[model samples]
Target chain A: MIEVNDIHKSFGDSKILKGITTVFDKGKTNLIIGQSGSGKTVFLKTLLGLYTPEQGSIVYDGRNYSDLSSDEKSDLRAEMGMVFQGSALFDSMTIAENVMFPLRMFTKQSKSEMQDRVDLVLKRVNLGDAHKKLPSEASGGMQKRVAIARAIVNKPKYLFCDEPNSGLDPRTATVIDNLIQEITQEYDITTIINTHDMNSVMEIGEKIVFLKDGLKEWEGSNKNIFKTDNEAVTGFVYSSDLFKRVQKMYLEEDL
Target chain B: MSYLHSIGQYFLMIKAMFHKPTKWSVMRHLIFKDIDDLIINSIGIVSFIAFFVGGVVTIQTALNMTNPLIPKTLVGFATRQSVILEFAPTFISIIMAGKVGSFITSSIGTMRVTEQIDALEVMGINAINYLVFPKFVALMLYPFIISIAMFLGILGGMAACVFGGFASLDDYIAGIQLDFIPFHMLYAFVKTFVFAFLLATIPSYHGFFMTGGALEVGKASTTSFVWTSVAIILLNYILTQMMLS
Candidate 1:
C-alpha cells in the first residue's frame, strides 16, 4: 500500500538516506527495523510528507504523494493515521478530545456522532472509561493505547507508527505490538511501523525491511530471521541478549 | 490568488485556532487573562516612564531656570509635553514590545516547533493566515487601549507631584498651555497607531520562521522583543524630529 522508489535525502553535506527503496504491503504489519539515527525516522517522515525527498517518489495507494499539492497531500493524510513516538498528545486537551481531533477536523460528523465514534474507538482500544483522563495522567503503556485509540479513531486506511512501543515495559510493548497487529489484520489496513525494539520485529513482523546506515540490508520474516545466513541480519539479531539466547538454544538443540 | 484558496485558508486557520476539543465558551474569559497580565506588568512599565522620563525631565528643566518671571512650575510644562509625546506612544511601544509582541512570537513559535503548525498544514490550513491574523487583530486593538492607560498613568504621577506641594495648580496649568500645540497631540496619536502596527507585524514575522522546539520559540520571542523595542525607539526619534520639532 506504500512504495518508496530510490528515495534520497540529504541535510546539506550530510546524507541521511542514500537511495533506499521499499514497499509496505496491505493487511500486514510491515516493520522498518534499525538502530537509532539509522534514518528510519527520516524515511517515515518522507512517507508522511513531513520532509521532501531530495530524490525519489513516494506512492501512497495510487497517488504520487511526494508531488501532490499541500491541500491534496492533506486530503491524502486524512485517509491515514499516525502514532508518534512520544504519543505527542496535545497536553492541553483530554484523551477524548485527542481521539476526536481527527474526526472533528476531517469528517463532517456532528458532535454526537463524533462522540459516538470516539467512544467506539476508545472502547476498541480497551480505554472506555479512561477517556476523561489526560495523557500525563496515563502511564506510558496506557498512553500508547490512547495514542492507538487516537490513530484509529478516524478509521484510516493506512497507519504509520514511529516506535509505538519505545518507552514501554516488555509486557506493555507486547500489548501495543499485538494491538497494532490486530488492527492491521482486522481492518486489512496497510500499517508500516518504525522500531528499534527487537520484540516487535519477532512478534508482529509479517514483512520486515532491515536497514543499516540508510541502505536496505535484509528483507525477511521473523520465522526465518534466525535461519538467514546473511551476516548483517545475523549480527543485528544476535547482538541483542534475548536473541543471542534464542540462537544458543536452537544451536544446542540441533547439536 | 485563487478564491478557493483564500476562503479555504481562512477556514483552515479558524479550524486550528479552535483545535482545542473543549467548548469555546471561555474565550471571553481568556481576555480577562490579558487584562490581569496588563495591569500587573504595566506597573513596572509605568514606573520606568514616570521616574526616569517624566520625573527626571521635570527636574532637568527645573535646573535650567533663571527667570523669576517664568513660573517655578516650568517643570510641569516639560511633564505634560514629554508624557504625551514621549511616554505614552514611545514607552508604551516598548512595553508592548515585551508584552504583546513577545507573546505572539512565543505562542506561534511554540506551535511551529511542536509540528502543531505542520498539523494545521496537513489539515489544509494556511498556517500563516490562521496563526497571524487573529493575533494581529488583537495586538492592534489592545496596544491602543494601553496607550490611553499610560496617558492617564502619567497624569496620575503629575498629581503625586502637585499633592507633595512641588507645584501649584495655577502655575502648572499656565505653563502647560504656554506653547501647547494641538498638532503635537495629533502627532502623538498618529505615532501610537504606527507603533501598534509595527509591534504586531515584527514579532509575527519572527514567529513564522520557528521550527526547532521550545528553545527556538524562546529565541524567536527574545529576538522579536529586542528588535521591536529598537524599532520603536528609532522610529520615535524620526517622528519626534518630523512632528514635535
Candidate 2:
C-alpha cells in the first residue's frame, strides 16, 4: 500500500500537481483517471520518484520515500516495476533477453535459472513462443504483453503502468487491462495505472482517483461512479452519447 | 548562453559517469559492442580515405616540383610530412565526426525519444554511466585505427611515387626515413587521443540530453556533428600552437 500526503509539484512558474492526497491499496487495481494535461502523468511520476514534490510526503507501506537514503531508494526501486506507455522494450534485444535483463542486473541466479524464470513469466503472459522475436517483429498487443512480462518477472512489490492502453485497439486494450488486473490479484501486488480509457476505468478500477486541473476532483470505484452527482466526474466520464445512455440505464436499474 | 549551458551539462555528465558504475560483466559486453560499432566498423572508411589522399598528396607534390634543382626524394618527404602531420589524424577524425558522431547521436537520441533512458532510470541504473562509459572505453582503441591510417597512408604515397614515375622506390624510402623526428609521431598520437575522446563524448551529450521526436533526432545528429568538428579543429589549433610553436 502507498499513502500520498498533500504533495505539491510545479514546473517553472506553473503548478502541475496540487496538494493531492490518496491511498493506493495492495492487491487492487488503483487507477488515476484524468483528461489530457490534468496532471495524471506528473502525479504518477511523482509517486515513482521521477519528480520530487515540493510539499507533503509519500509513504510506501511504512517507509517515507523522501527519508530513505540513495542506496535505500535504489533498493526500493528494485522491488518496484513499471510498464511505460510505449512498452520501452530494448529494440536491440530479443524478447527473452528483454525479460531476462532485470534479472541479470539484480539477481544472483545462474543463466539457466534466470532463463527458467523468464520462460515461466512469458508463459504466464501467454507469450511462450515469442522468446526469440525482436520487439519490432511483435504485434502491438504482443509488445504490451512482453512489457508486462518484463515488469512482473522480478516479482515486484509494486507495479505502475503509464497509459498502458494508449495506441492499442479497443480489443487489445481490454486484454492488456485484464492482464494487469489478473496480475495484481495473482501476485497481490500494489498496482497503480494512469489511463484515460473509460473502458479501463469501468473494468479494472477497484480504487479510482479522479483529477482535474491538478486537483483531486472525485474518488470512487466503478460501482459508485455511476451514482455520483459530481458534475466534473459525470461530465468527464459520460461525455460520449453511448456512455451517457449507459449511465441512464445504470441509474434506472439502480432506481 | 545555450551553448554555455550545454557545455556545463556535458562536463556534469562526465562527472556523473564515474558514480554508481554498472556491473563489470554488463559493462564488458557494452564495451565490446561499442568497439565493434565505433572503431572496427570505421576502419574501412579511414583506410580508404587515408590511402587515396596520401596518393593524391604525393602526385601533387611531385608535379609541383617542376624545378630540376629539387630532388626527386622531396616528393616522398613532402608526402610523409603531410600524411603524418595532418592527413591521417585530423582530417580522418573530421570525417569520423560526420560518420561515427552522427551515429552515436542518432542512436542515443532515438533511445531518448522512445523513453529507453527513462526505463533505465526507473530500474535504478545511472543512465549516463550505463550508456556513455562503454563508448569512452571503446574509443581508447582509437589510436590503433589512426596508427593503421598512418602506415597505409605512407604506403599509398610509396605506391604513387614509384608507379607514377615521380621517384624511384629507393629514393622515396630514403626521403621517408630522412629527418624522422620521433617527437612528431608522438605529437600526432597525442592529438588523435584527444580527438577520440571528443568524438565519443560530444555526440553522447547531444543525444542523451535531446528532447523531441524523430525529426529532433536528425537535428541533434547534425548539431552534434557540427559542434564536434568545431571542437576538434579549435583544439587542434590550440594543441599545435602550444606543442609545436
Candidate 3:
C-alpha cells in the first residue's frame, strides 16, 4: 500500500498539487483521473519520485520516500516499474531485448535464464511472436503490450503506468485496461495508473481518485461513483451525453 | 545568463556521468556500439577529405613559390606544416562536428522526446552514465583517426608534388624531413584529444536538455553543431596561443 499525506508540489510560484492525501491499496487498479492540466501527471510523477513535493510525505509500504538515503532510494526504485504513455521502448532493441533490459541491469541471471524470463513475460502479454520485432514494427496497441511486458519482467512490487490507453482505439483500450487489472491481481502489485479515459474509470477503477484544478475532489469505488451527488464528481464523470444517460439508467435501476 | 546556465549544466552532467556508473556488462556493449557509430563509420570521409585537401595545399604552396631563390623542397615542407597543424586536426574536427555531432544530438534528443530517457531513470539507471559515458569512451580512440588523417594527408601531398611535376620526390622527402619538430605532432594530438571530448559532450548536453518534439530535435542538432564547432575553434585558438606562441 502507498499512502500520501498532504502532498503539495509547485513549479515556480504556481502550485500544481495542492495538499492531496490518499491511499492506494495493494493488488488493486488505482486510477488517478483528471482532465488535461489538472495535475494528474504531476501527481503520478511525484509518486514515482520524479518530482519532489514541497510539503508532506509519501509512504510506500510503511517507508517514507523522502526520508530514504540516495542509495536506499535507488534500491527502492529497482522495485518499481513504469510504462510510459508513449510506450517508450528502446527503438534500437528488439522487443525481446527491451523486456530483458531490467534483468540485465539489476539481476545476476545468466543469458539463458534472462531469455527464459523474457519469453515468459512476452507470452504473458500475448506477445510471443513479437520477440524479434522492433518497436517500430508493432502497432500502437502492440507497443503498449511490449511496454507492459517490459515493466512486469522485473517482478516489481510497484507498477505505474501513465496514460496506457491514450493513443489506442476503444477496443484496444479495453484490452489494455483489462490486461493491467488482471496483472495487478495476479502479481498483487500496488498499481497506479494516470488517465482521463472514462471507460477505464467505470471498468477497472477499483479504487479511483478524482482531481480538479490540482486538488483531490473525491475518492471511491466505481460502484459508489454513480450514486455520489458530489457536483464536481458528477459534472466531470457525466460530462459526456452517453455517460449522463448511463448515470440516469443507474439512478433509475437503484430507485 | 542562459549561456552561463548551460555551462553549469554541462559540467554537472559530466559530474553525473562519473557517479553511480552503469554495470560493466551493459557499459561494454554500449561502448562497442558507440565505437562503431562514431569512429569506424567516420573513417571513409575523414580520409577522403584529408587526402584531397593535402593535395590542394601542396599545389597552392608550389605555385606561390615562384622566386628562383626559394628551394623547391619548401612545397613539401609547407604542405606538411599545413596538414599537420591545421588541416588534419582542426579542419577534420570541424567536419565531424557537422557529421558525428549532429547524429549524437538527434539520437539522444529523440530519446528525450519519446520519453526513453525517463524510462531509464524510472528503472534507477543513471541516464547520463548510460547515454553519454560510452560516447566519451569511444571518442578516446579519436586520436587514432587523426593519426590516419596525418598519414594520408602527407602521402597526398607527396603524390601531388611528384605527379604535378612541381618538385621531385626526393626534394619533397627532403623538405618533409627538414626542421621537423616532433613536438608539433604532440601539439596536434593534444588538440585532437581536447576536440574529441568537446565533440562527445557538447552535443549530448544539448540533446539531453532539449524540450519539444521531432522539429525540436532537428533544431537541437543544428544548435549542437554550431556550438560544438564554435567551442572547437575557440579552444584551438587558445591552445595554439598557449603552446605554439
Candidate 4:
C-alpha cells in the first residue's frame, strides 16, 4: 500500500499537482485517470519517487520516501518496477536478454539461473517463442507484453505503468489490461497505472482516482464510476458515445 | 547564463558518473560493445584518411621544393612533422567528432527520446555510468587508433616520396630519422587522450539531456559534433602553446 498526503508539484510558474492526498490499496488495480494536462502523470511519478513533492510525504508501506538516504532510495527503487508507455525495451537486446536485465543488475544469479527466470517470465507473458527476436521484430502488442514481462521479472512489490494501453488495438489493449489485473492479484503487488483509456478504466479499474487540473476530483471503483454524478468525472468518463450509451443503459437499469 | 548553467551541468554529470557504479558483470558487456562500436569500427576510415592525407602532404612538400637549396629529404621531414603534429592527432579527431561523436549523441539521444534511460534509472541503475562510462573506457584505446594513423600516415608519405620521383627511399627514411624528437609523439598522444575524453562526454551530455523526439536527436548530434570539434581545436592550441612555445 502507498499513502500520499498533501503532495504538491510544479514546474517553473505552472503548478501541475496541488495538494493531492490518497491511499493506493495493494493487490488491486489502482488507475489514475485524467484528461491531458491534468496531473495524473505527475502524481504517479511522484508516487514512484521519480519526482519529489514540495509539501507532503509519500509513504510506501511504512517508509517515508524523503526520509530515505540515496542508497536507501535506490534499494527502495529496486523493489519497484515500471512499464513505460513506449515499452522502453532495450532495442539492441533480444527479448530474453531484455527480461533478464533486471535480474542481472540487481541479483547475483548465475547465467543458467537468470536464463531460467527469463524463460519463466516470458512464458508468463505468453512470449515464450520470441526469446531470440529483438524488440523491433515484435509487433506493438508483442512489445507491450515484452514490457510487462520485463517489469515483473524481478518480482517487484510495486508495479507502475504509464499509458500501458496507448497505441494498442482495443482487443490487445483489453488483453494487456487483463494481464496487469491478473498479475496484480497473482502477486498481490501494489499496481498503479496511469491511463486515459476508458476501456481500461472500465475493464480493470478496481480503484479509480479522477484528477482535474491537478486536484483529486473523485475516487471510486469502475461500478461507481458510471453512477458518479460529479460533473468532472461524468464529463471525462462518459464523453465517448459508446460509453455515454453504456452509462445511460447503466443508469436506466439502476446499476 | 545558460552557457554557465550547461558548464555546471556538464561537470555535475562527470562527477555523477563515478558514484553508484553499475555491477561489473553488466558493465563488462557494455564496455566490450562500446569497444566494437567506438574503436574497432573506426579503423577503416581513420586508415583511409591517414594514408591519403599523408600522400597529399608529401606531394605538396615536394612541389614547394623548387629551389635547389631545399633538399628532397626535407619532403620526408615535412611530411613527418605535419602528419605527426596535426593531421593524425587533431585532424583525425575532428573527423571522429563527426563520426563517433554523432553516433554517441544520436544513440543516447534516441534512448532518451524513447525513455530507455528512464527505465534504467527506475530500475536503480546509474544511467550516466551505465551509458557514458563504457564509452569513456572504450575510448581509452583511442590512442591506439591514433598510433595506427601515425604509422600509416608516415608510411604513405614514404611511399609517395619514392614513387612520385620526389626523392629516393634512403633519403626519405634518413629525413624521417633526422631531428626526430620523441617528445612530439608524447605531445600528440596527450592531445589525443584529451580529445577522446571530450569526444565521449560532450556527445553524451547532448544526448542524455536532449528534450523532444526524433527530430531533436538529429539536432543534438549536430550540436554535439560542433561543440566537440570546437573544444578539441581550442585545447589543441592551448596544449601547443604550453608545450612547444
Candidate 5:
C-alpha cells in the first residue's frame, strides 16, 4: 500500500499540491486523475520522489520515503519502475536491449536467463514479435507496450506510469489500460497511474483520487464516480463528453 | 550557493561517469575517433604544413644570414620553439574543440533534455558520474598526446628544409637542436594539462545542464565549442607570458 499524508509543495509562493493526502491500495490500479495543471502530475511526481515535498511524508509499505538516505532512496527506487510520459526508451538500444537493461544493470542474471525474461515480458505485453525492433520501428501503441514490457521486466513492487495513454487512439488507450489493470491484478503490485483519461478510471479504477488545483477534491471507486452528486466531482466529471452523456443517462433514469 | 551546488553536482556527475558500463566504451570510441580525426583527416594538411614550413624557415633564415652572424640553424630552433610554445597546444585544441568538444556537448545535452539522465538517476545510477569521469580522464590525458603529435608533425615540417637543400643537414641540426629545457617542457606540459581540463569541464558542464529539446542541445554544442576554443586561445597567451618570462 502507498500512503501520502498532508503533502505540501510550492515553487516560489505559487503552491502546488497543498496538504494533499490519499491512500493507493495494493493489488489494484489506483489512479490519480485531474485536468492539465491540476497537480495530478505533481502529485504523481512527488509520490515517485521526483519533487521533494515541503511538508508531509510518503510511506510506501511502511517505510518513510522522505527520510531515506541517497542509497536508501535508490534502494526504494529499485523497488519501483516508471513509464515516462513519452515512453523514454533509450534510443541507442534496440527493444530487447532496452527491456533487458534493468536486469543487466541491477542484477546478476546470466545473458540467456535475461533473454528469457525479456522474451516473456514482451509476450505478456502482446509484443512477442518485437524483440529485435527499435522503438522507432514500432507505432506509438507498440512503444507504450515496450515501455510496459521494460517496466515489468524488473518485477517491481510498485509500478508508476505517467500519462500512458495521452497520444494513443481510444482503441489503443483501452488496450493499454487493460494491460495495466491485468498486470496490477496478476502481480498484485501497487500501481499508480497519472492520467486525464476517464476511460481508464471507469475501466480499471479499483481506487481513484481526484485532484483539483493541488488539493484532493474527492476519492472513490469507478462505480461511485459517475453516481456521486458532489459539485466539484460532477463539475469536473460532467465536463467530459462521455461523462456528460453518462450524466444525461443517469438523470433520465429518474423518469 | 548555486555555484556550490553546481560544484557538488560536478563531482556527482564525475562519480556517475566512472560507475557506468558505457563510460569505458564511449571513452574508447571517442579516443579512437579522435586519433583518426587528428591523424587521418589532417594527413594532407600536415604534409603541406610540414613541407612549406620547413622550406620557408630555412630559406628565410638563410637569406637573412649576414656573414653568418647568427647560425643559419637558428631558424630551426625558432620553428621548434614555435611548435611547442603555441602551435601544438593552441592550434590542435582548436581542431579538437570543433570535433570532439562539440560532439560531447551535443550528445550529453540531448541525453539531459530527453530525460535519459533522469532515467539513470531514477534507476539508482549516478547519471553525472556515469557521464563525466571517463571523459574527464580522457580529456586530461589525450590533449598531451595530441600536443606531442603536433610537435612531432612540426619536426616533420623542419625535415623538409634539409631534404630540399634549403639548408644543410648540419645547419638544420645545429640551429634547432638544443639540450632539453626541463622548465620549458614543464610549461608545455602544464599548458596541455590545463587546456585538457578546460576542454572537458566546460563542454561537459554545459551539456550536462541542458534544458528544452534538440534545439537546446545544438545551442549548447555551439556554445561549448565557442567558449572552450576562446579559452584555449586566451590561455595560450597567458601561459606564454608567464612561462617565457
Candidate 6:
C-alpha cells in the first residue's frame, strides 16, 4: 500500500496539487479522475517521485520517500513500474528488446534467462508473435499491451499508468482496462492510474479519487459512484445523456 | 540572467554525466552504436569537402601568382598551409556542426517529445549518462576523421597542382617540404579536439533541455546549430590568438 499525507506542489505561482492525502491499497486498481488542468497528472507524478512536494510526505509501505538517500531512492524506483500515455516504448528497439530492457538494467540474469522471462511476459500479454516487430508496426492496442508487458516484466511492487486509454478505440480501451485490473489482482500491486475515461471509472475503478481545481472533490468506488450526491462528481460523471439514463435506471432499480 | 542560468545548467549536466554510470555491458552497446552514428558515418562528408576545398585553395593561389619572381612552388605551399592550419580543422567542423549537430539535437529532441527520457529516469537510470556519455566517448574518435581529411586535402591539392599545369610535381613536392613546422600540425589538432567536444555537448544540451512538441524539435535543432556554430567560431578565434600569438 502507498499512503500520501497532505502533499503540496506548485510551479512558479501556479499551484497544481493542493495537499492531497489518500491511500492507494495493494491488490486494487485506484483511479485518479479529473478534468483537464485539474492536477491529476501532477498528483500522479508526485506519487512517482517525478515531482517533489513542498509539504507532507509519501510513504510506500513503511518507508518515507523523502527520507531515503539518493541511491536508496533509486533502488526504490527500481521496484516501481510506469506506463506512459504514449506507450513510450524505445523507438529504436524491437518489442522483445524493449520488454527485456528493465531486466537487463537491474538484474544479473544470463542472456537465456532474460530471453525466457521476456518470452513469458510476451505470452502473458498475448504478444508472443510480436517479439521482432517495432513499436511503430504495432496497433494502438498492441502498443499499450507492449507498454504493459515492459512495465510488469520486472514484477514491480507498484504500477502507475498515465492516460492508458487516451488514443485507443472503445473496445481496445476496455481490453486495456481489464488487463490492468487483472494484473493488479494477479500481482497484488498497488496500481494507480490517471485517467478521465468515464467508462474506465465505471468498470475498473475499485477506488476512485476525484479531483477538481487541485482539490479532492470526492472519493468512492465504481459501485458507490452511482449513488454519490456530490455535485462536482455527479455533474462530471453524468454530464452525458447516456450516463444520466444509466444513473436514473440504477436509482430506479434500487427503489 | 537566463544565459547565466543556462551556463550553470550546462556545467551541471557535464558533472552529472559522471555520476551513477550505466552498467558497462549495456553501455558497451550504446557506445558502439554512437561510434557508428557520430564517427564512422561522418567520414564521407569530411573527405569530400576536404578534397574539393583543397583543390580550390591550390587554384586560387596559382591564379594570384602573376609576378614571375614568385615561385610556382608556392601553390603547393599555400594549399598545405590553408588546408592544415584553418580549412581542415575549423572549416570542416563548422560543416559538421551543421550536419552532425543538427542530427543529435533532432534525435534527442524527438526522444524528449516522446517521453523516452522520462521513461529512463523512471527506471532509475541516469538519463544524461545513459544518453550523452556514449556520444562523448564516440566523438573521441573524431580526430581520426580529421586526420583523414588532412591527408585527402593535401592529396587533392597535389592533384590540382599537377593536372592544372600550375607547377611540376617535383617543385610542388619541394614546396610541401618548405619551412615545414610540425608545431603547426599540433596546433590544428588542438583545435580539432576542442571543436569535437563542442560538437558533442552543445547539441546535446539543446536537445536534452528542450520543451514542446514536434515543431519545437525543429526549432531546437535550428537553435542548437546556430549556437554550436557561434561557439565554435568564437573558441577558434581565442585558441588561435592564444596559441599562435
Candidate 4 local lDDT, B66-140, one digit each (tens): 999987779889999999999999999999999999999999999999999989989889999999999999999
lDDT of 2 by residue, A1-255 (tens): 999999999999999998999999999999999899999999998988889999999999898999999998988888888999999999999999999989988889999999999999999999999999999999989999999999999999999999998999999999999999999999999999999999999899999999999999999898888889999999899889988988999989989
Instruction: DockQ for candidate 6, please give it.
Output: 0.86
Two-way lDDT contest, 4 vs 5, winner: 4
Instruction: For candidate 4, give the lDDT of residue A127.
Output: 91
Using lDDT, give the best candidate's number. 3
- Candidate 2: the clashing residue pairs are none
Q: What TM-score against the true fold does each predicted structure earn? A: 0.81, 0.98, 0.98, 0.99, 0.84, 0.99
Q: Candidate 2 vs candidate 5: which has greater DockQ? A: 2
Best model per DockQ: 3
Superposed Cα deviation of residue A161, candidate 6 (Å): 0.4
Interface RMSD, prediction 3: 0.6
Alpha-carbon RMSD to native, per candidate = 6.0, 1.2, 1.1, 0.9, 4.1, 1.0
Candidate 6 i-RMS: 0.6
Q: At residue B205, what lDDT does model 3 achieve? A: 96
lDDT at A234, model 1: 87
User: Could you give the CAPRI-style class of model 1?
Assistant: acceptable
Which regions of candidate 4 are displaced past 4 Å? none
- lDDT at residue B13 of model 4 (Cα atoms): 96
Residues B29-126, model 1: lDDT tens digits = 33444445434455565555555455555555665676777776676777777777777778767877887788778876776665566655543445
Q: TM-score-based ranking, best first?
A: 4, 6, 3, 2, 5, 1
> Residue A146 in candidate 6 has what lDDT?
95
Give the per-residue lDDT digits (tens) of candidate 2, residues B36-136: 99999999999998898889999999999999999888988999999888988899999999999999999999999998888888888889999999999
Model 1: residues >4 Å from true position, as ranges? A132-134, A248-255, B1-67, B72-76, B105-115, B121-124, B170-190, B201-220, B237-245
Indicate the worst ten consecutive residues by lDDT in candidate 3 chain A: A221-230
